[model samples]
Target: MLQVFRKFFHSSVGVFAALGLIVMLAMAFAAGDVSNMMSSGSITGGDRVAKVGGNTIGTAQLTKQMQQAVEITRQQQPGVTMKSFLAEGGLDLVLDQMIDGEAQMAFGRKVGIVAGKRLIDSELAKIPAFQGAGGKFDQNAYLSVLAQRQMNDADVRDSFARDLVSRQLLAPAQFGAALPQSAVMQYAALLKEHRAGSAAMLPSSAFAPKGLPTQAEVSAWYNSHKAAYTVPERRVIRYARFDESVIKQSSVPSDAEVAARFKANAAQYGASETRKVSQVIVISESMAKDIAAAVAKGESLEAAAKAKGLSVASLGSVSKADLTIKSSAAVAEAAYAAKAGATAGPVKGALGWALVRVDAIDAKPARTLEQVKGEITAALTEEKRKQALAALTEKVNDDFGKGGALSDTAKELGLTMAETPLLVAKTPAGMGLPAELASILPAAFGMDHEGQPQISELVAGKSFVIFDVTKIIPAAPAPLDQISAQVMADIQLEKGSVAARAAAMKLLAAGKKGGDLAAEVAKLGVALPPVQQMNLGREEIMSRGGQIPPAVALFFGMAPGTTKLIPIAGNKGFMAVQLKAITPGAVAANDPLIGQVKGELNNLAAREQGESLRRAIRTEVKVERNESTIKTVTSTLAGGN
Candidate 1:
C-alpha cells in the first residue's frame, strides 16, 4: 500500500515504517507473547544496546523485538531463521526502529509534549489484541495477556504511551502537505514509458554432461544441502466427537411438563383479533366529518384525505388496545366497531378529531391444550436438549481439566475414537480432513508433543470434540540413502544450472561485443527455445496483472542496448535479456491521469515530509550507540557469544 511513498522517500521511510512496526510489536507481545519463542538462555540482564538521550535500550528488549520480528516474518516466510534474519540485516533494522521510536519519545518529552494516561488508555483499548470475543476491550483479557507475557500493567501502559506520544509529535508535521502538479508529472511519465526487448532461455540440460552424477558427488551435495530437504514437523490428532446423543440425560418432555408449559403461556394460545385501518386527523370535528362523509360516499379514504390537504396513514394490524394507546379510546372503539371495508367515524382522538376506515379484520379462535400439545412438547424438548447438551459439554471440560484422557472418555461414553493422518500446520487440498478438525489445527499445533486432551466446540451448543496430540513427527532431514535417487537427480540439475549460467554469460558477452542476439543464440549447438520478442509500456505490463516475469523485469531495469542474464528461480535455467529500443512516455497537461498521479503523489509527499521531520527530530535528540553491546546481543540471538 505504501510502495509509492517508500520509493519516493527510500532514505527516510524506515522511521515511518517503524511507526507501524512499534504498534505491531507491542500488540503482538500483548496478544500472543512471542517472547517465549526463543531460548531464555540467550538473555543476560543489565546490558544496554544503545542510549537515546538519557534513556537506555536494554539487550533483553532488543532480543525480544528481534524474536517478534522473526515470528512476524515467518508468517510470510515460514522457513526464516534467526541466523538468516540477522544475515539480511534484520537485527540492525529492528534496533534502528527501536532507536527511532525512543528518539521520538525523548524529543517529545524534552519539548513538554505529554501523552495523558487517558489518551494512552484510549489508544490501548483500540488494539485488537486486548479485545475479547465480544469485540470489546475486555479488562480480563487485557490482564490475562499481561499475566501470560509476564508483564505488568505499567509495562503495557508505558509502551502504548510511547506510541501515542510519537504520533502526537509526528502527525501534525505532515498534515495536509502536498506537491504541485509540475513535480508529479515527471514521475507519472515513467509509468507510461515504452520499452522493447528480446529474451532467450538457455536450458542447462542441453549443455549438461551425459550419464549420471557420481555417487560421491550426490553424497556431497546432499550433505551440504540437507536443510533444504528437511520435512516440516507433523502431528497426528486423535479425537472423539460427541453430541447430545452421547449424554445420558433425557431430553423428551413428559405430558405433565408439556401441560404446565402450555398453562404458563396461556395468554399466547388465547383467542385474538386485530384490524388494519387507515385514519386521517383534523383539528376541527367539522373537517373530520367532511372527510368521513366523503369516504363513505364512493370516494377512497386516501383520495378524500388528499383532497382535504392531508394524507391517510395506515395503522398496520393494530388491536383495540394498541389503537387506543396510539390515538384515543373513542378512535379504537369506532375502528373495531365498523366491519371490514366500512368507514368508522368522525371520532375524537388524542391527536384531534379522527376519521377511521377499516381495511381488514383478522381473528383467531382460541386453541385448546390438545390442539397445541405437540408444539408445546417440541419446545420443551428442545429447551431440555440444549440444557442437557450444555451440561454434558461442561462435564467433559471439567473431566478434561481433571487430567482425564480422551481415549478413556470415549470408552466411558461408548464413543468411537478416530485418528487423523500426520498433518502439517496447513491443510492441503484433497486431504479429506474434516472441517471441524481443520479449524482446531492452530490450537493443536500450539500444543507440545502428546499434550493433554482439550475440549473444543465443533458446533456451538450441538457438537464438540475432545482431542489430543497422539504422535508428533519432529522436523528432520531424510537420510541420504532413503532419497538417493532424488539426490542424484538434484545433483544433475545443479550441474545443468551451472552449465546454463555459463552459456548465458557467453551469450551476454557476445551481445555486449556488438553481436546480434538472435544470430548468437542460433550458433549455440544446444537445442534452445526460440527468442521471445516483447514490446510493452509500463502501463501495458500493469494491465496484464499478476507479477511481471523476472526476465521482463530485468529487461525494463536495463539501459537500452545492454544485455543481462536473468537467473530462473529453482535452478531451471536463465533468460539472456537484451534491451533493443526505448520510447519516452509523453503526458499532456490536461490528461486526467495527471490529476490522479498528482493526488497519489501528494499523499506520498506528505508522508515523506512527516518522516523527514521524524528524522530531523532524531538528529536533534542525542543518540548514543553502544556498538560492542549491540554486537553481543545480535551474536547471542544468532546462537553465538
Candidate 2:
C-alpha cells in the first residue's frame, strides 16, 4: 500500500525503492558511465547544473548521469536513433529528471538529512548487483567492478548513503496510508500486473468511421504531426578509428612470462578443493524429527535417505573445501555426525531433512611446484602480452598525437592499416560505434583532417578506439529503381484500401454477432491461426510483438470471447482482433515508485519532526562554493529540450 510505503520512506533506506536505485546502478554501468567520475564541470545552460547550498553540481557528474540515461533509454528502445529520440523528447526528459534529482539531493542535504554508513552498508548488502554466482557478497567482484567504474569505497558509501536518504524521503509520501486502501490497489494495478483471463480485439477496419476528406484528410493529418515527416539533418563523414584489437593477432605467451604470472598470482589462479555428497530435502522441523527418529531406530541410512526425497552420490573421496554441503553449518552438523569410520544419522540441516554419512573425505594439499609450472608459465606470459599490448597502444596514440599519421605508425609498428566502409555521422552499423560517435566523426572530415589520426577517448578501455572512417556516404532517399517493387506493392495495398474496409466492416458486424474472426477470414479466403494465449508485460509489449497487431495489447484487457475494434496505424500491417477471455498476466506488485514529489513530501514530514536536531548539526559544519562557476557549467547542459 502507498501508506505502507510512506511509513518506511523516511527511514534513510526503505525496503522497496533503494533496490530500484541498485537496479539503476546496474543499468548505469551497462549504460557505460558507471564511474560518474566527472562531477566538477560547467554546462552550456544559464541554469546551474548542480547547486547544493551554492556548491554547484559538477559537470562530470552531470555528463555521467546524462550518459547513464542515454544508455538506459537505448536499452529501452535498442537501436533507437538520436534524431528520433530527440524528436520524442525522450533523452531530454531523462536528462532533466536526473538534474532535478541531483538538485533535490542537494536540497535534502541543506535541509539536514544525512545517510549513515550503517544504512549504506545495509542497502549495499541487499543489492543483487554485489552478489556473485554463489549468491553472497563477493569482495573480489566488488573490487574489480569498482575499479573498472573508477569508484572507491568512500565514493560508493557516500553515493549509496545519499540514494538511501533520497529513498527515505520519497517513498512514503508517494504511498502513505493516509490515502485509502482502494487508492493504493488502484495505483497498484495501473503500475503492476493481474493474473486472470485472456483477451481478443476488434479493429478499425471493421467499423470504418466515415470521414473521407478525399486527399485533404491525409494532408491535414500530415500537417498536424509534421515533425514526424520532417527530414532530419545529417552529415557526410570520413573518420579513421583505430584500436589495437583489429590490428593485433594474439600470440602464444612466452613460457617464461606465463610461469612468472602463474607463480605471482598462484593463490588466485589454481584450482579449488571439490567434494561429493548426498542430500535429503524436507519441509518442516517436525517431519525432520520424525525422519531422524525413524533413522536412529536401526533403519538403513539408504532407506532413510530414500524415505525422504533425497538423491545419493558416490565419490571415492573429495576435499571438504570443494563440497557445497560442507559450507553450511546445518550440512556440516549432519555430515560430522560420525567419525571417519562411522556413518552419521538423522541430523538436521538448514533447508530440510539432511542427514550425512561421510562416505569419503579428502584433505586439500598444496599442488607441487612442478605440476603447476606450465599453467603458471602460460598465465605469466599472457600478463606480459597484455602489458606489451598496452604499451604498444600507448606508443601508437603518442605517435598519433605528435603529428604522426595512422599510416606512418602502422608502417613503423609493422601494423596494417585497415579501412571501414562508409559510416556517415548518423548511420553506424558496426557494434562498436555509438551515437556519441556522431560528434567525433565530423572532426575526421573537418579542416586538417586527412591523415590526421583521430584518436578517441578509450571507450571500454584505454586501448579501445573507433577506427577511421574509410568512406563517406551521404544519406540518400530511396531511388526509383531500388523502390520500384515496393512502390508497386504499396500502390496495390493502397488501392485495395476501400475494398478492404468494406469487407472488414462486414466482418466486424458478424464478429459483433459472436461469430469467430477465423470464420470471417475463411469467408474471405484468407487464413489465420487460432488465437493462442500469451502473457504480455512491459518488456514484451514491443515492436518485436510489433507484428502481433495492436489488438494484442488492447484485446488482453477485453472480456473473454467478446469483440472490441481498434486501429493499428504503425509500421506493422493493420489487423483486426476479437476479445478472447482475459488472461490477467502476472502476479503481485513488488515495489513502489519514488518520484520527486514523493521525496519532497517525505522531507517536509522529516523537517517537522526533526528540524531542530538537524539544524544543530549543520550549524557546526562549514560549506562554501563559487556560484558563478557552477552557473556557467550547468547552463550549457540546460534548456535543450
Candidate 3:
C-alpha cells in the first residue's frame, strides 16, 4: 500500500492532479452520442445512453448531470447567459464528459477496483481548499466550497472515488513509460542546429524621388484602405467623486476620546521582551552537560557539536508567549534572566536534553498613552471619515437609482464634478484621471450607450464615483486635407519601395549570371553593402561585431547557397539573404536537453496508452441512446420556450 502511494506521487497524474481534475471533469462531461440521446422523450430502462459492461447510464442520470453542469458553468462565469453557454457547445461538452466518466466508473467496478471510505476520507483531508484558519480540515469550509458549486458531500466523494479507481487501473501505463534513446538524440540535434548567412539591405529612401503622389493615386489608395483610417466610436463621461477627504475637520475625535480609546486597547500598546538564543538538543542529559561545559571553557557550541558528530540549530528570536515547544518555557525563562553572552541549561525537552546559550536581549519599552495619543487620534479620525464616505456613497447610489441627473447629484451631495475628454475603449497612460478610474474605462465601454449611471469603487474602497456617459461621438475618417502632409510622405515611400525592389531584382539577376554584385550595384549609382558572416540559431542571430538583422534568421530553413529577398520593417526596404553554410551543433548522449526531450516523449506515450485503455473498455460496453430527453434538456438550458 505504501509503495502504491509512492508510485502514484512520482507519476505525472500526482504532479498535475489539480489541473488534471478540471480537464477530467470537462472530458467526463463531453463524451458519447449526445445528438441521438437528446432526441428521445420517454426514456425507461431502454433509454440507457451507454452500458459499460453490466452498468447502464439512463436518461434520469444524464439529466441530473446536465443540471449540475449548468450550475457549474454559472459559477465559473457569473453573468454568462444560457444561450451563450449553449452556443459555445457547453451542453454537448458536458454530456460527452458524463458519458466518459460513467464508462470509466463502470470499467472500474467490473475489474473490482473500488476506493474504500478510508481512502476517500484521507484524500479529502489533504485538499488545501477544505482547510480552515487553523490549517486543519474544517467540515463547514468543505461543505461551503461544495455548496458554492452546487455539489454535496456524496457528489464530491463519488467523483474522487472514480478518479482514484481510474488512476489505479491506469498505473501500469503511467509508471512504465519511456522514450527511445535515438529519438531523444535526434530531437536534441535538431533543436541545437545552426545556420550561417549573409544579407544586403536595400533602403527605400535611397531610391525615392522628391515628390508628392498624383491626385488619382492618392484617391485610389484612400478608397482601397478606408477601414484602416476610420476611428472607433468614443464616449465622453461625466462623474462626481466622494471620498474621506470631504469629511469635516470638526468630526475628528477629541483628545479625551483618543486617551479613552488607547486605554481600552492597552495590551496593544504594551511590549514583550524577546531573546535571541541558540540550542543543541541531544539524546541524553550527560551529553548535554558535557557540551555545556565545553562552551563554558571558551569553545563555541557549533565547534562542540562538530566534535561530537552533531549539529546546532538556531532558535532565532522568540518571546516567552511564542515558546510553545516542550520545556520551551523553562528555556525561555533561563535565557531571559541571563545577560548577553551568558550560557545556561542542560534542560530536559520533548526531543531530548537541550544546551542553550543567550545571544542577545531585545527589551521593547512600553509606549505611554501620551506617546501614542496622536496615532490613536489619526486612526479614529480616518475611521470616522471612512464611515462618512460610505454613507455618502450610498446616498449617491440612491440618488442615481431615483433617476437624478449626474450634475444635479453632484450639486446636492457637494462633490466635485468633472467631465472627461472624448476617450476610446483603450485608455492611454498619463491621462489626467487616476489609475482606478482608467481601469474602469473598459467596463464602461461595454455598457449600453444610454444605460443608467454606475457607481464604481475606487482606490480599493478609499473613494467612490457615480458616473454616466454624457455623449457618444460616432467614428468617421479624417478629412483628406487634414492629413495630406502625412499621406504625401506615405505615397513617396511606397514609390521608393517599388524602385528599391526593382533595383534589388536587377542586381540579383546579374549576380546569378556570374556578374560581380559590387560592379552591378555601382552601375546603378549605388554602393555595394559589405557582406558579413552570421550564425543563426533558435536563440538569436550573431555576427562578429553586432547582432544580424532578424529577417535573415529565416535562412536557417534554407539550403546552403540559397538566396531570397525578405521584407524589412515599415514597407520601406528589403534584405536580400544568401545562405552561406549550415552547421549542426554537437549534442552529447547524456546532455540535459536529451533528458528533457525524453521526459516529454515519455509523458506523451503514457497519455496515449491511457487513452487506448479507456477506448478498449468503452468498446466492450453496450450503449443505448434516448435522443428526446437530451433535446428537452438542451432546449430548456438554451432558454427555449
Candidate 4:
C-alpha cells in the first residue's frame, strides 16, 4: 500500500507527460496566426508558440495537438475556459512543460546518446494500440500500423528510438523498492485502527484574549504581505464570447439553387474514365525478368507469368483515373510507355508489380437532374446554411457595439440576457461561459477604467461578439470587526488547551487510585462522551490525532487492558488510553494482491530510477531560461497600462 502510494505520487510520468503536452501546446499557440506561418524563419521567436532545437514547431502541427488537448481537457473539465484555467496558470504550466520537453530533446541530441531498439520495443509493447483482440502484442497489427499511418520501417524505428530515449531520460527516480514494511504497516493501521480518546471544545463565547491590537499589528502583517493585498492593475472593456458551432445554424436553400448547383458541379457528383488491364506480379526481380523474356518469346503473358511464379490477373471495370497501377508514378510510366499488349519492365510498386497489358477503355457520362437532384440539394443547402451563420454572427456582434450592450442587443434580436456573478478575472465559471472567454482574460485584466464596454470582433471557436468588465473588487486586509472576534476566540481555545493540560496529571493520579473513568472525567465539571472500545490501527489513530491521536501509538504500545499516559505532540494535554487489541499483517505470496503490489513496486522502482538518472544528467546538462523575460511578459500582460 505504501509502495503504491509512492509510485502514484512520485512518478516522473507527470514530468514527461507535462513536457510532451506543453511542447504540443507551444507548437499550437506559437503557430496561431496562419499568415505568418510560411515566411516566419522559425517559431522559436516570441511569436512562435513552441520550439524544438531551432525548428519552428509549426502552428499547423500545434493546432492539431491543441485540438487533441482541448478534447482531453474538455473531457477532464467539461466547462474549463481559457480564462479561468489560465488565471490559475494552466496555460503557463502547459507552455513550460512543452518548452521543457523541447529543451530536453535538444539537450539529448547534444550528447552522443541515442535511444536503443531494445528500449523502443520494451516501451512499444506497453502501448495498448499494438495489442490484439486478446490484449497481446499483435505482429499483424504492428505491420498494419506501418501500412496505415504511412510509416515506413524507418519511421517506426525513429518513433521507437525517441520513445525509449525520452522514457529513459524521464522515468521518475522516486520509485522505492519493497515499500518499507514500516510504511505499509503505518498506512494500513490508519484504515483499521484508532485510539479511544476525547477532546473538550472550549467555546469561543466563554473566553477572551489579552492585549488587543490597535490595528497596528494587523496593519503590520498586512504591510509585510503588501503584494497579496495589491490588486493587479486591470482594464475595463467590451467583448462578446462566441461559440464555434455558431457556424452551423439553420438556413433553408431553395430548390432552384440546389438545381443550379447540381448543374454547375454535375461532373463532381459522378465521373469516371474506365479502363480494363491485365498484370503479372512476381516475388523477385530475376523471376520477373525471366517472365518478361518468356512473354516476348511468342509465349502468352499469362502462361509465362504462371511458369515464373507470377500471378496474371485482370483489373475488372476500374476507372482509368482511379487505376492503382496507373496512379503510381513508377507503374504508370512503364505502363503508358508500352503499346497495347506490349510487355513493360519489372516495375516494382509499393507492394510489388511487373509486366502489364492494356486491354480496353471506356468513359463515363454526366447524369440529369432527376438522377442527382437529392444530393445536390443537400450540398447546396449546407453551403447556404454556412453563409447564413456567418451573417448571423456578424449581425450579433455588430448589434452589440451599436450604442448598446448584449442584453439590449439580444432583446432587439428577440433574445434574453442571462446575468451571473461570482466570476473571477481568470476563471469565468458557468456553462454559459465559453473556454475562449479565458483566452482574452489577460487582456481583460489590462482594460482601463470600468464600465466602458469593449467587444471582440470574432474569435475562432468562440462566436460571442461581446465582453464588458462589470466590477473590480480591490483586495484589502480584513477589518478588525471581522477578524478580532475570531482572533479572541482562538486565544481562548489556547487558554482552554492549557487548562486541560494543567488537569492531566491530577486526573491521571485519581484514575490510578481506582477513581471511575466516567466519575473522574465528570469531576473536572466537563461533559464527556461515554467510554467506548476503540481499537484503531497505528496509522488510523495517529492521523486522527486531533480527534483520536497518533499518541495512540504509545497507547497501543501499552499492554492490553492497561492504561498509559502519552503526551500529545504539537497540541495540548496528555491522554490516558487503554489498549484493547493488536493485529499484524504479512505480505502473502500467490495472492492476487501480490500482483497489484508488484506493479506498484515496479512503478516505484521506475520512478526512483528516473529520478536518479535525472540527477546524474543534471550536472552535465546546462539550462538557461529567461525567467525574468517571462515574468516581465506576464506582468506586461496582466498590467494593461
Could you give candidate 4's per-residue lDDT for residues 1-641 as a string of tens digits? 11221232234343223223322333222112121222324433554454444544343443344344554466447786544554676545554434444445555678655667776566546545456766677878766654654545554445345444454456433434456655544444334444444323223222223455445655555456445444443333344344434444455667787777876776776655555668776668888888878877889888887776557788665554455544356666666556666767788865565676766655567677877777777777667765765677667656645755655654444544433343446555333355545555655566564544455544443354555666666555545455665444444555655765655655667656655444566676654445444645554544565674455456665654445566555344456555544555444434454455456665776667765655454334433334443444444444433
TM-score of each: 0.62, 0.38, 0.60, 0.42
Best by lDDT: 1
Alpha-carbon RMSD, candidate 2: 15.0
Candidate 1 vs 2: which has more lDDT: 1
Number of residue pairs clashing in candidate 4, backbone atoms closer than 3 angstroms, sequence gap of 3 or more or interchain: 53
For candidate 3, write residues 1-641 as lDDT tens digits.
Answer: 22222332344443233222322233332132222233323334455544444445555656555554554455447777667767888766666566666666667777788889999788767666666766678999777766655555765666667666666776665677777787778777877777876667788877787766788888877777667677788888777777766655455898888988998999888986877888888898888888888988999989987788899877888776665453467776776777888777887766788777788888888999889988998999878777777777788778878977777777766888788888888768447455658866876677677536878887765877778887787788767777666666777888889989998898678656655544556677765466455666744543333555465556766677656677778988777766666777679867887877788888998888877876676775544445665676667666775
**Candidates sorted by TM-score, best first:** 1, 3, 4, 2
Alpha-carbon runs more than 4 Å astray in model 2: 1-74, 78-273, 279-354, 359-366, 416-448, 454-641
Model 2 lDDT per residue over 521-631, tens place: 557643333444445543344326556555566655565566555544632223555654443333244444423224544555555544343333333332233345444
lDDT of 2 at 446: 56
Shift in Å, residue 575, candidate 3: 5.1
How high is the lDDT of residue 625 in model 1?
74
**Per-prediction RMSD in angstroms?**
10.6, 15.0, 8.6, 13.7
How high a TM-score does candidate 3 get? 0.60
Worst 10 residues of 4 by lDDT: 27-36
How accurate locally is residue 483 in candidate 1, as Cα lDDT from 0 to 100? 92
